[model samples]
Target: MNKQEIGTFLLRVMLGFTFLMHGLSKFQGGLGNISGWFQSIGIPGFMAYVVGTIELVGGIALIFGLGTRIISVLLIFIMAGAILYVKLPAGFMGNGEGTGFELDLVLMIIALHLGLNGSSFLSIDSKLPNRKRGQVSDKMAS
Candidate 1:
């Protein structure tokens, strides 16, 4: 296997898994509490469900490399929303009661990379029928 492809696959899978867990957590027991928190923060409570759904579906898409580019873009927006609407006020390092946007930033950067570079040859994106050779590839060239 191409090493660059391997690296890209690793990155995508890890990112996907992280989002999946986060989304799953939102539904596991805390969705209502999280929704209430969202409303308390001035956001509509329904947004919690929307965000949770996107994170859950997008996470799965990324994991399978099924919709890497689109999912990555969506994830970027989610991260931006998290940073601007929630984490920014917490301070860069974090507050006594809450964490900060640093993690969101990192996740966004990774999504950005995947958005720009696409999933590599190891991904389902590459193996899909009707895809042109080299149409989807990572730029790492590792």
Candidate 2:
């Protein structure tokens, strides 16, 4: 693969792996505790579950390069919501306790990049036939 392809692959792998771990942590009472914390912050408990499930599924999809564009877009929103609802009030430097918005900010940037560029050379979406590749017009001069 070219350097561009390699870079894309690396970005996807790192982002996907990080997100997957975050999601996995949730099911192990990490997310449940987080949900309770959200409730304390005035966020609805059910919404926390919804966001967690989205992160889990979207992170897996991103890792496998399956429907990458869609999953990436979804993750963008999830990260955005997290930043707005949870982190912003805590401030960028966090509540002076090291808990901060930096990680979420980085994830948001990565998700935004994925949403824009989509999966690269190794992705299933790239391998699949697109309309331009599969369809032929009858109004051909050839």
Candidate 3:
């Protein structure tokens, strides 16, 4: 419940919701187009499914504070790919050819922070009755 915890929770929720929406959009708006776009970008079409699943699942997990660090790591990889493959060519401001990598960079940084620090006491990981070593919880933090 400290400032850092509150900030982390906000970041976690924000990043999670963002990924959730993107993942949901990929499916709701039709993965066929996403798959085609991936293929066009030189990535395997099937990776669309993999990325979508990870985003959706990872988003939910992050929101609930379950496996926060692991999920954050996965999200970091996704953002990296996005920046490297798609957004970099678009320039920092998009330059009129799709969106830029700024947001991706931000998200990647958030994920990096989560991966390094883990989640707050409000997380399920923290609430677990018996936690493994290295896991941070309210009591453990105290």
Number of the top-ranking candidate, with TM-score as the measure = 3
Residues 1-142 of candidate 2 have per-residue lDDT tens digits of 7887777677777788877777777777677787898799788877768777777777777777877777777888877877887778778879875467888888878777777887667777777756585567565535
Instruction: For candidate 2, give the lDDT of residue 25.
Output: 76
Tens-place lDDT per residue, model 1, 1-142, is 7887788888899899999989998989677988999999888999899889888888988898988999899899989989998899888879987898888999999999899988855577778765466776555453
Q: Which ten residues in a row have the lowest lDDT in candidate 2?
A: 133-142
lDDT preference between candidates 1 and 2, better one: 1
In terms of lDDT, which candidate is strongest? 3
Identify the runs in model 3 with alpha carbons over 4 angstroms from their true place: 129-142
TM-score-best of 2 and 3: 3
Model 2: CA > 4 A from native: 30-32, 132-142
For model 3, how does the per-residue alpha-carbon lDDT over 1-142 read when each residue is reduced to its tens digit? 7999899999999999999999998899788889999999999999999899889988988999999999999999999999999999888879886999999999999999999999865789888687667899897689
* Clashing residue pairs for model 2: 26-31
Q: TM-score rank, highest first?
A: 3, 1, 2
